[model samples]
Target: MSRLLGLLGGTFDPVHNGHLRAALDVCEAGQLDQLRLLPCHIPPHRQTPRVDAATRLQLLQAAIHGEEPRLVVDDRELRRDAVSYTVDTLHSLHLDFPAARLCLLLGTDTFNGLPSWHRWRELGELAHLVVMQRPDFSATDDPVLARWMRERRTEDWTDLRAEPFGRVLFQPVAQLGISASLVRQRLAAGRSARYLVPEPVWQQIQQQQLYAAP
Candidate 1:
């Protein structure tokens, strides 16, 4: 049986429930042996995170510390000091885990903007894409993306064990209507972010007074 390694990368400004839940869901859904929650140093697609990479990495460590094997935090992108590109991370992972099936997990929103990513097409060559489909998204609506999806779509993840890369699998997972931006807003407003983020992360936020108005 080929080991399946999953990578979920993001700018975890303050690791929240949604991020953790999505990581857990993808691990179980994809039967991934280890799913690394990667923290980006400089996000290529989005604005630079308000919090520093070290702080965000600390929050990620607190959020996933007790949970090992199933979930772990990868700081390669954070340590690189360059714009975090998914393709670069995938390429590195491919070299590290040559025998295992490498899968990159992304939400539907991310998948929809796949073309905008740096070297997006090369991503599939390095790792299988496990796109988490949302109830409201329609990737088929885009002519270019629709054609791309058509050529690489696969119905079974078992096929991943046979081949190392170039498969696109769309799997439906529980969509929690949570966002890190919302949590930050709540924290900035001095409101309760209790349920929105994990306790350890919440504690870290309070301890460090993160996202508080200056």
Candidate 2:
């Protein structure tokens, strides 16, 4: 079987517990050899983060420090000056490890809004989409996406293991109602974001005095 490399990209403004849990859960579920947590330099879909890219990268480094074997911090997107598009990142990964199977991890919310993304259709050709199911939305709610899901969805993990790319997989993960925005809100309001983020990450944010003001 070909090796599986998972990519989980986000702004990772503070790298919270929800992000860690989902990454760990998906690594086990997908049987990935290593999962790279990519922090986006610029997000086209949302407002620019209050925290700078450097700080976010530092926080990501801190969050993934002891998670070496299963998780690693990927700074490719941060190094790229242009807007961080998922397809572009996948294409780069495909080039770097052409023989290994590349899986792009995404939440259900992001998957549902795929049409709005830059060159979204080409994403499947570059890497397999592993959409983690969320409670608020379903693929069937969007007819176009539902049809695409029907055509490309894979039921067998072995099939993913055999191929290098081009398939979609829906996974059920623990529903944690935590988000980066919420974590920022709590911190900015001078409340405890202690359990929301990892210890090292929390310490870094506290020491740097980040997100103390809205």
For 69-159, candidate 1 gives per-residue lDDT tens digits of 6898888898797888888888787777888888888888888888888888898888888988778877656788889888889988788
Q: Which number leads on lDDT?
A: 2
Q: Which 10-residue window in model 2 sums to the lowest lDDT?
A: 133-142
Residue 92 local lDDT, model 1: 83
lDDT (10s digit) by residue, model 2, range 1-214: 8899889999998788889888888899888999998999999999898899999999988888888978988899999999999889988887888888888999988888888899987988888889877666555577877787788899777778877667999877777789999999998889989988999999998898999984
The true-versus-predicted C-alpha distance at residue 205 of model 2, in Å, is 0.8
- Global lDDT scores for all candidate models: 0.85, 0.87
What is the TM-score (0 to 1) of candidate 1? 0.96
Question: In candidate 1, which residue ranges exceed 4 Å CA deviation?
Answer: none
- Worst lDDT run of 10 residues, candidate 1, spans 133-142
Clashes of each: 0, 0
User: What lDDT score is found at residue 41 in candidate 2?
Assistant: 90
